[model samples]
Target chain A: MLKVLKYSFYDLSRSRWTYAYLLFFLLLTFGLLNFSHDLSKTIISLMNVVLILTPLIGTLFGALYYYNSKEFIDLLLALPLPRRSIFLGKYLGLSLSLSASFVIGILAPMLLFGILSTGLVLNLVILMSTGVLLTFIFTAIAFLVSIRFEHPIRGFGAAIFIWLFLAVIYDGILLLILIWFEHYPLDHFALLMTLFNPVDLSRVLIMLQLDISALMGYTGAVFRKFLGTSLGMSIAYATLLTWIIVPVFAFLWLARRKDF
Target chain B: MIVRDLYKSYRKHQVLKGVSLGLDPGRITAVLGPNGSGKTTLIKCMLGMVIGQQGEISANGKNIGHDYLYRKDIGYLPQIARFPENLKVRELVSMVKDLRNQPANYEELVSRFGLGPFMQKPLRNLSGGTRQKVNILLAFMFDSRYYILDEPTAGLDPLSLQRFKEMLLNEKQKGKAVLMTTHMVHLAEEMADEVVFLLEGKVYFHGGVQELKDTYDGMNLEAAIANILSLQEHA
Candidate 1:
């Protein structure tokens, strides 16, 4: 398993695509911070760009990697290593690489932006968490998709469709749903939906923390109540963890059953 | 090994229909057939890489798909010779040995295959023939008991092909079971102990290579195959 993980990272490091992504994010944050010295401005800018972009790109790129590396995966399978170990090894490796980028990429910019204050610390923590959460969540999703789709283009198409639905269309549909249920008490239901969708929840939590939850529409306050308290935040964290785990186990199940 | 009434279909098109065959050690077998004749499918069934509709494949005194220990001693080189892009030749060789549950001098394997000159090169950077050489080396490096090499000499040069044949014969000397598929009749004519001719998802013939050659009078092995296939087609 350690061998698998080590080789997985080694393979990942060889790709100029991954290197480009890391540099793009790092430079984007660095340049954005220079544009604004205010800590909140920097945090929001980073959050908006990373939250909307990283998951889809990460999921697509990760899925692409899985498909393109079929030869390697088959080689791994040919060895005496258990399917679970190989699958988990690659998953852990991908997580670490993306997580390192998320942490270090944002940290460098935060330090240079003169972030030596309490608010800066909070903003940095929040920003870093969002990046890792995005990476892990999409990695889980990507792993499952990659195992399921044998064709690389098809997997990419499916990933984009899924990202579009989760990131955009789902929100529109939920808005109409909330409007239809305006006469009834749907705050709990609204909170449940937010928990189910981590992307919306992450953005909503950050907005509420910045004391601007009202702009998130009526569903924001309901989510704030469920995600604002210490316990609420912990529950939100657990939900994010579930987002990462559900797909992880699903991918493992598929990997084990996959003929490759 | 035993495959009892095996069946496999891709969506609505049935590729394998109630095919059954038995295999044993110390014999070199050839799955000879044209394209889409289900020869590869049969190999996949034996490896449990493809799930059949209704069948049980057993190998080495244990039921196939249920006994992984049987596979622990098997070395498989897939139909296509592919490796992880950007992997050094030595790294790929080392990875296979590691998976085979042992460690060996990977550089030795590389040097033996004349891959030392390209040792640090990436897989994608290598030529098709070189990649095929790498695949062959990895399959035979660990000294497996059961070897399934698909089109093993597809891109090999004459000298390398001769070396590979010698290597296969060495495995035969160890009493290992080798099931190889090939389009080159000459290699099969030279290396195989048994010829299992596959046609339209079924085993039309399974016997020693001499038995196949001597089946039809006054015809060479290739001519005999053409005659037998034409007869099958007409029948």
Candidate 2:
């Protein structure tokens, strides 16, 4: 698996898209910092972009990489390596590269603005970790969709739709549900719905960490009441970790039975 | 290597039905059939690329269903030479060697195919024929005991084709088993010591080149195969 991972990382290291992704984050971070010297405000602004953009790029890049590497995967399948190794290696290689870009793209600008000397370093850390987690979760889901659907267009379309549903539509539907159940105590329902979507879960987690739950209205105050404790925070992180684990195992199972 | 009573299907369409054959060392067996006749399916089943719904494939007397290490002895050349874009030929070759963790001497094969100039070129930059040459080189680079090539000569020029044929013959002389599928019947006529004719998921004929010809009134290999297909269509 490590051997395959090394080669995969090497293969993707030259990808122009990865560099483009990194450069986009750099420019965004630098631009945001230039506009606001207030460190907390910049972190919150960066959080919004990371929540939407990381998952989007992860989905698109993951699907594109899988389709493009179909031939390479066939070649690897014929070799002595196990199917688990080839697939998981590719997934990790992609996720790690994207995570590296996200980290560097954010960190370079944060360091330049003298973030280390301030109290907001931990906030930036939380923001970057959320970005990395989103990368892994969305990439794994994209890989699963691509593996299940053989045609490139269908797989790419399905992946993009998933990102759309999770990042945008899921919130809209949640809003409708909240309005429909306006008379009842609905904090638990709202929390459960947030847990179902990694994107929303990440947003709540970041907003809570930034100490801006008051700005989130009633749902924010409810989120702070439930997720303010250390125990609740641990559970949220565990849920995010589960999001990464489930899709990875599902793809590995599919890869084993699939015919090249 | 032996494949016994193999059966495979995609959805409701059965591709291979109860096909059986054995590969002997130091001989070349050409798997021939019309389009969609399970030639590639059978090859994939044996290599465990496509799992058979019902069958047993054994390498050196061990069942290969749950074992991947058995593939270490077989070198496979797929139908098309698909490679990662932006990867140089030299890097691809080295990557395979690194993955296999075995001593491989690809220098001689590269020189024989005259791919020295394209060593530093990215795989996508090479023409189809050059890519095919690279595919052939990768399949023959390691000294494996068995070679399974699917359409091994698809896009080669005459000179590279000749070199490829010579290299295959050299491997056969070294007591390696070579199983290949090809549409070029004349090339099969020249190189195959035996032939396995698959017609509609079954082996219609499995015998020597001359025996197949003699059975069909001494016609050439291509016409003999065509005759089998025509007879099947009539029946």
Candidate 3:
């Protein structure tokens, strides 16, 4: 498995798109820092971009990587390696590479501006960890979708729809539900809904840390009132970890029964 | 290797039904069939690439059911020579060697196939024949007990094809089991000690090459196969 991971990492490192993704972050961070001297405002801005873009890239890249490496996978299937190793190795390799890009891209510019001395360092850490967690979660979902659907376009379509559902549409539906049930005491309901979508949970998490009560919305407030700040943050992080783990195990199971 | 009572299907279409055969060492057995006749499915079943609905595929008297370690003793060349496009020939070779953790006689095979020039070239940049050469090189690199090749002669120039045939013969001389599928009847006639003809997911014929030729028309293997299909058509 480690050997597979090493080679997969090597292969992805050489791809031009990996560098392009890294460079995009580098430029975005630098541009955001240059435009705004306030570090808190910059972290919030980066958070918005990170929440949306990381899942998108993770979905597209995960599906595309599976479709592209299919032939190579056939080669691997004929070897002595187990299916678990081939698939889990690929998932970890992809997540690590994308996480590395996000981390390096975001950290380099912040370090250049000397963020270590500021109290905003903790906020930056939360933002970066959420980005990494989101990358792992969505990449795992993409792998599960791709492995299930043999057609590349179908796989890609399903994967993107999942990201869309989790990152955007789910929240929209939750909003409609909240408005419809506004008269009732819906605190627990809203908090449970937030836990269902990693994207929203991450947004609430970062907003709570930044002490931006306005953007935290009703669910984030419920999160704070019921669980307090530290406990709420811990629960959110644990749920995000669950998000990453469930899909990975699901895909590995599917890979074993797969025909290819 | 022995395959007994093999059955496979894709959705509503059954590809292999009650197909069975035995492959012997020290000889080359050719799996010949028309398109969509489940020839590839049978080979894939043995390699455990495609799972069979109901069957038993055993290598060295042990059932190869969800067990991958047995594959180390088998070398396989898939029908398509597609690979990770970004990987250079050398890297791909080494990657396979690393994954299997087996010593490979790759240098000799690379030189024999004249692939030395393309060692540093990415797989996407290589010509179809060059890719096929790489496929063959990988299949024959390790000293495995069995060889399963699908369309092994595709896109090969005459010299390279001759070299590949020589390699197969050498492997056979070392008492390795070889199961290959091909459309080229002449190649099958010249190389296969026994031929297994598949039609509509069944082994219609399994016997010595000369016996197959003699049973149909006392002519070449191609005409013999043509006669069998025509007879099935009339029936």
Candidate 4:
């Protein structure tokens, strides 16, 4: 398993795109955090970027990577290698890479801020963990999209459109609904929606810790009430872990059953 | 190696219709046919690359698809192979070795295929024939029990062809099953222990090359193939 992962990492490390993404996002994260004095404001500034763009870029890049490497995969498939190990190797390598980038881009700046103000260190750790989940959730979605679509462009377009709908359009429409139904507290409805989208849940949880989550709506309150408890936070992380493993496993099954 | 009544279709169009054949270990069995006559599909089915709708394909006493625990003992050279542009010869060999979970003697493969001087050069710089040679080396690397090659010598010089034939003979000597599909009937005539002539989606004739010549009013395989096609039309 370690060898497989090591090989996967070696393969990706050779790719110029991987290094470029890491460096580009690291610079971008630093720029965003330095946008303001108050960490919450700096965070909201970056949130606009992270919530909308991180998953979109991650999904598109990951999907494109898969599509472009079909010949390599065929060579591998012709060998005695098991399909499950291949999937795990790729998932672990990609997840580890994106998490490392997230740490550099988002977590590092926040961690430095948390150090100056000691109480928020745990809050910052929770927030970064949420980013890890968010990255994996999107990576899985992208993997499925890449396999399902015959054309790489089609897969990339579908991923971008999904990101647009989920991150931008869905939130916009939901806010409109919330404002109109001010008398009716849709706390449960928001929780269900957040659970469905790890990205949304991540955003809400981070904002709740910063106590500047008014725009995050009922979802923010639910995460604060539930995930504020240490056990609830652990359960939330566990659920995110499931989101990572399930789709990848499904992809393995699909690839195994597929007539290559 | 045995192939039991195999059936396959692509959506509404049937490609292989209840085809069955056997290949003896230590001998090359050439599958000869026109395009879209299920020659490629049959090979693909045996590799479990294409799903057979009915029946089973067994090599070394195990079914091809689900019971292919024996793939560790199989080598496949696909019709067309593409390599990464920037990868050197060593990188290419390394990639396959990692996938196979076996250590390959790079010197043996490189020297055998005349890839030593070209080792440092990227795959993009190599000729099409060199690329085909790379694919062949990868296929013959571990020397498993079964070899299924499609258009095995499409791009090769006389020397390379001789080397390839020698490799095929070596596999046969080791009692490894060799099934090949090729347009070069001359090579087929030279090497085939038995000839399976297919037309449309079914086998029109299955016998030795000499049998094909003697039974039909033809001198060699091309005429024999023409005779089979005409017979299929008459039938």
Best by DockQ: 2
- Tens digits of per-residue lDDT for model 4 on A13-124? 7877777767766676667666655665565566656665668766876787778767766666666666666666776777677767776766666666664565656555
Per-candidate TM-scores read: 0.90, 0.97, 0.97, 0.91
Better structure of 1 and 4 per lDDT? 1
TM-score of 2: 0.97
Badly placed stretches (over 4 Å) of model 2 are none
For every candidate structure, what is the RMSD over all alpha carbons to the true structure, in angstroms? 2.7, 1.5, 1.6, 2.7
- Per-prediction DockQ comes to 0.44, 0.82, 0.80, 0.53
List per-model TM-scores for chain B.
0.91, 0.98, 0.98, 0.92
Comparison by lDDT, 1 against 3, better one? 3
lDDT of 3 by residue, A101-152 (tens): 9999999999999899899999999999999999999999999999999899
Rank by DockQ (best first): 2, 3, 4, 1
lDDT of 2 by residue, A1-260 (tens): 99888888877888888899899989988998899877788898988999999999999999999999998899899898889999999999999999999999989988999999999988988899999999999999999999999999999999999999999999999999889989998888999999999999999999999998899888788799888999889999999999999999999999999988
After superposing candidate 3, which stretches have Cα over 4 Å from the reference? Answer: A214-220, A227-231
Cα-based lDDT at residue A79, candidate 2 = 90
lDDT, candidate 1, A1-260, per-residue tens:
78888888877776776677778878988888777767777777777887788787768877877877677777766566677878889888887787776677778777877787545677677767877888888877888887898888888888777778878888898889989988998888888887778788777767767777887666677777677789999988888899988999998988766655
**Runs in model 1 with CA error above 4 Å?**
A113-119, A180-185, A214-221, B1-4, B66-69, B105-113
Candidate 1 local lDDT, residue A64: 75
Local distance difference test scores for all models: 0.77, 0.92, 0.91, 0.75
- Interface root-mean-square deviation of model 3 in angstroms is 0.9
| Cα displacement (Å) at residue A58, model 1 | 1.9
* Local accuracy of candidate 1 as per-residue lDDT tens digits, B134-154: 887777776677888789898
